[model samples]
Target: MLNRDWHKTYRMPEHPTLDQRVDWHLAHAIACGCREMPDTIKREIEKRGLAVPERNRPN
Candidate 1:
């Protein structure tokens, strides 16, 4: 189910930096299950050698 309340509370910023995108998506993975993290964001995270959060992992 979509978490409309979470979406309303956590809008992504315009032209967000990579750090902001990563942080927002990580939080979203915990708070909402509406969608998968974007591939671009995942690539950037891996490129930076940062571990993807456990909650964001695919089943």
Candidate 2:
């Protein structure tokens, strides 16, 4: 479960349900592992201003 308050730290609005956020986060995690993003997924994360933490970046 995600901490609701953590959204503020991520600069993510709480408008979307937690399930929606989790879904996107999971997809993003997969993308990060590959060290590549398709245009569509790239745009989604950019629109949300989500940053891939260094820890999550492909090693």
Each candidate's number of clashing pairs is 0, 0
TM-score of 1: 0.69
lDDT of 1: 0.78
lDDT of 1 by residue, 1-59 (tens): 34778788899999999899988987887777468888888888788898766553324
lDDT of 2 by residue, 1-59 (tens): 13333333344345866546545565545444334444555566566677543324544
Model 2 stretches astray by more than 4 angstroms: 1-14, 33-59
Q: How close is candidate 2 to the true structure, as a TM-score?
A: 0.32
Q: Per-model C-alpha lDDT, please?
A: 0.78, 0.48
> For model 1, which pairs clash?
none
Worst 10 residues of 2 by lDDT: 1-10
How many times do residue backbones clash in model 1? Answer: 0
* TM-score of every model versus the real structure: 0.69, 0.32
Clashing pairs in 2: none
